[model samples]
Target: MRMIAAVMYEQGLPAPYAESSPLKIEEVELEGPGEGEVLVEVKSAGLCHSDLSQVAGLRKRTVPVVMGHEGAGIVREVGRGVTEFRAGDHVVMTVGSGCGHCSFCVNSRPVLCDTVAASRGKGVLTNGARKLRRNGQALFHHSGVSSFAQYAVTVPGTLVKIDPSVPLEIASMFGCAVVTGAGSVFNAAQVRPGQSVAVFGLGGVGLNSVMAAKIAGASTIIGIDLNESKLPLAAELGCTHALSALDPTLVEKVRDLTHGGVDFAFEISGSKAAMTTAIAVTRKGGEVVCVGLGASADLYQYAHTALVSEEKVFRGSLMGSCVPRRDLPLYLRYYQEGRMAVDRLMSGTMGFDQLNANLDLLDRGEVLRQVLLPNG
Candidate 1:
């Protein structure tokens, strides 16, 4: 098969992930599934900031890679020995593909699987060969699912099977933002019912946090973001309070609403100030989960006074602490039943050629959650 993908050569400099090399869509031959791998004709792929982060060199990963992880499509081909899925199954790609025997994979934290370098990164296929190439050069699949292209090859476990009734556009977002954002709260934070919660950023993850907070029965679900354009959507998603990211009264307002502080706070924006304020706005002994990918290590720092006295619990959650095959289908059901309002999170649909145009919105402080429909 011949497919076009957004390939990155170097990182840093462009907004929404600096592209050391501009992502150009070009035709490349795709590898057939060898063993336990399935080939999906990407129906819809969500363009995540992480993809931008990698291109911009913020998110740590290999380059000369095809960018995109969250995607949904139909299984057109299956590798030999694949028992669970057959061609024609509707599916969403997972970033985490475990060996199913490693301690991390066995412990239900496949997202943290230790063999990340060996598999599930911006490289060639798991079989150690190129799946796609352009002009006699190798083009790697970023995070194992270069869904930005028209087709992708991945392991069976790396895909979450979904029902055919759900629209591919909605299903695509579930592959990442929905699962990561919502899962971080309900699964990682284990948010208690009636607890106070605040989420920073109202993009895909932040909005998912709001929905998850509502599902978790949070009493005060506050959403903060610089874009006043996003608050209306945030409110529709069950955010009880929306604060301007620039408002100086933001922290105090959250504290007042929660009657002291929120019990759980999640920082989903890739902003240093948001991360610090998220930790600060939470009550004593509260938990703060960092869900966004900031520029670098220097982007994050904490004060001892805020931690020692309050007994604040800080954790870096990767992929919502998810076991994808377990969480993806679960969130899919939420969307299918109209309980999640996932359709509300979409910002706009852009054609594949407009990818950079869509990504540029992230740097300009626009775009809530955007997806690219190559099929469109």
Candidate 2:
């Protein structure tokens, strides 16, 4: 089948992406699902910072790849040996696909699965196949989910069946922002009642972290970001205090607000300076959960002695350290109960024509979560 899709042929295009046009929209060939794969008609996909990183050349990926990983759609067909999902089932696509036999998969850590890692590194589906083509030439898959197109063929391990009642646009965020942000609070940080929390970066992920901390009963939730526009929404989403990341006394203010420092700090901005602020605002014996992806070679500098003596833990969280099959439903339940309020995070929806311009908006920190209706 031929479908309209956004294809990236190069990386590190100069900014003003509206002009650089890193992603080219064109008609491409999509193959049917093979063994253990499923064909999905993508209803909605989200433009995430990770996508921006790939466009800006901060993250390297195989060229000529369909560029989207966060999406929700309906399963149109199931391939051989696939019994868990079938035609017409609503589902959300995730980046963490695992070979069921791997140690990480068996240990309930599919995000770290060895097979998925290798396949992602090579930009192919977990089964080691490329299902996208243009002019009879193969195109690489993005995180096993080339969802920037109207349809996608992906492995079952990367999809989770969801309630049809949920809006596909809202559900699209669960794949990346919600899962990674909320999962950090619920699973990685494990904030308990009365714990103090600080979130550095008030984008979709950081806002979700704020909501999750509120749900987890955190007494104080501090939202930090360089964009003052996001501060109001952070407050609306359960942040007790919203502060500028650029403040000269930001660390001191956070420490004073939390009566020393926060129990857990989440770094979601992918900025090295934000990571430093996250670490500085965490109390002794506290933990700093790093959820953002920065440049491949960027190294975070911190006080090693303080890390050892204070027992402050700096941990890396991928896809929220989530087991998609187990956590997606639970997070969806939170959404259903009206506790998550994810809809508020959406900036707006756009089509392929505005995709590049939207990237410029995201680069300028003018939006939170932008949904792409590929089928439209």
Candidate 3:
């Protein structure tokens, strides 16, 4: 089928993407689902920082690719041997696509699945197939789910069946920001009741951490970000304390607020500086969870002695170390119970034509999350 979708021809275009328009909307051909895959009519997709990074050349992908990873949709058709779903089923797609037989997959860590991880960067399905084309020329998929388009073909494992009652626009975030953010807190950090927590970077991911910490019964939840515009929303999303990342006493402030640093510090800012701050704000024996995916060339420099002397634990969390099939439902339950706030986290919603404008806002940290309604 031929459909209109955003395609990236090149990366790192100059400011005012309106002129360069790195992601160009074009009529492209979409392939149907093959064996073990499904075709989805994308209802809504979110503009994430990771997508912006790809546009800015911070992350590389196959050019002429449909560029979106976070989305929710209705199953239009199921491929051969697929019995778990059928037409009209609502679902949220996950970025991780693993070979079912892999050790990581069996261990409940599909994000680290060897084959899927490799295939994602190569711009193909887990089965090493391309599902997009333009004028008979193949176009690569983005992260195995090119949701920027009207339709997407993905492996069965990449999707998690969800309650159709859930709004697709809000549900789209669960695919990336919510899962990665909340998972980092509940699964990776495992914050207990009355524990103190601090989250750096108040984007969609960091804000979700703040909300999860509050729901987890945290005594204090601190949010930090360079963008002052985001501080207020962070507070509204359950942050007990909001501070500027620019404050010279940023670390000291957190230490003071938590009365000797927080028990858990989450680095979701995707910055080396924020990673340093996350470590510094944690009390002795505290754990610092790195949740951001920054530039490949960037490095986190720290004193190795601190790890042993302070007994501080530093861990990297991918996809919130989430088991999507299990975690996605749990998160939705929180939202249903009003314990989580996915709706308030959404800054705005726009049509697909405004893709670049929304990307500019995300790149500037001016919005927590912007959902794109393809059919609108």
Candidate 4:
């Protein structure tokens, strides 16, 4: 079938993406799902920094790829032998997929599966097939999702069925930011009620961590970021205290605010400095969860003795150590119970025509979470 998609034809485009138009909206050909795959009509997709990183050369990938990972859509068709989902089902797309028999997939850790790792790195599906074409030329898939288009062909593992009544725009964020942030708190840190917590970087992901900490009954929840503008939103979401990460005494202030140090500190900014600060703000034997995705070459540095003597735990969380099948519905129920504020996370919504403008806002940290209506 014919469809329209935002295709990244090249990388390292000039900034002010609203004017440069890095992704070209063009007519493309989409193939129907084959065996074990499903076709979905993407209703709401969020513009995430990971997508921005790809277009800005901060991350490299196969060019001419349809880029988007955080999205919610309705199933339009299911391929043969697929019994888990059918037409009309609402689903949240996950970033990874794996062969079911693998040790990681058997244990509900698909992100670590070699199949997902190899495919996502090459911008292909789990089966290594390209389902998109521009005038008969193949196009790479983005994280096996490629949801920036009106329609997407993905494997069943990449989707989790959701309640249809849930608003697609808000549901879109569950795929990435919510899972990464809340999962970092609940799954990675195993935060206990009444514990003190601190989150670094108040973007969509960081703010969600703040909300999760509050839901966990944290006594103190602090949000730290370089941008002052994001602090107010952080407070509104659930942060009990907010501060600029640029302050020379930021770490000291965190320790003082918590009456010593927080029990748990999360680094969601993907910056080396933020990671350093996250580790520094934790009390002795405290746990620090790193949920940020920075450049591959970047590394975090800290004194080696601190790990053994302090008994501080440093954990790297990927997709919040989430099993989408088990976690997405858990989060949706939290939203329904009014315990999670997924609605407040979205700052704006737009159509494919406004894609470039929204991308610019994301690059500038001018929006928390923006939804894209690809069908428009």
lDDT of 2 by residue, 1-376 (tens): 9999999999999999999999999999999988889999999999999999999999789988999999999999999999999999999999965788978899888899988988998999999999999999999999999889999999898899999999999999999999999999988888999999999999999899999999999999999999998998899989999999889999999999998899999999889888888999999999999999999998879999999999999888899999898999999999999999999999999999999999999999999999999998
What TM-score fits each model? 0.95, 0.99, 0.97, 0.97
After superposing all C-alphas onto the true structure, candidate 1 shows an RMSD in angstroms of 2.0
lDDT tens per residue, model 4, 33-117: 9999999999999998888888888778887899889899999999999999999999998794566778999988876898788
lDDT, residue 257, model 4 = 91
Highest TM-score: give the candidate number: 2
Per-residue accuracy of model 3 over 292-312 as CA lDDT, tens digit each? 988878777988998899999
lDDT of all predictions: 0.81, 0.94, 0.89, 0.89
Worst 10 residues of 2 by lDDT: 96-105
How badly does each model clash, as a count of residue pairs?
4, 0, 0, 0
Off by over 4 Å in 1: 13-21
Worst ten-residue run, lDDT, model 3? 93-102
Runs of candidate 2 with Cα error greater than 4 angstroms are none
Give per-residue CA lDDT, model 1, range 1-376, as digits (tens). 7777776676665554324235766667776888778889888988787876766667566667777888899999998899889889999886766667789988898777766546655375555556777777777777778888888888787688898999888889988898889988978999888898989888888899899889889888998988898898899889998889889888888888998898888988768888889987989999888888777665478898869988999878888888888888788777777779999878788876788767777666687678788767
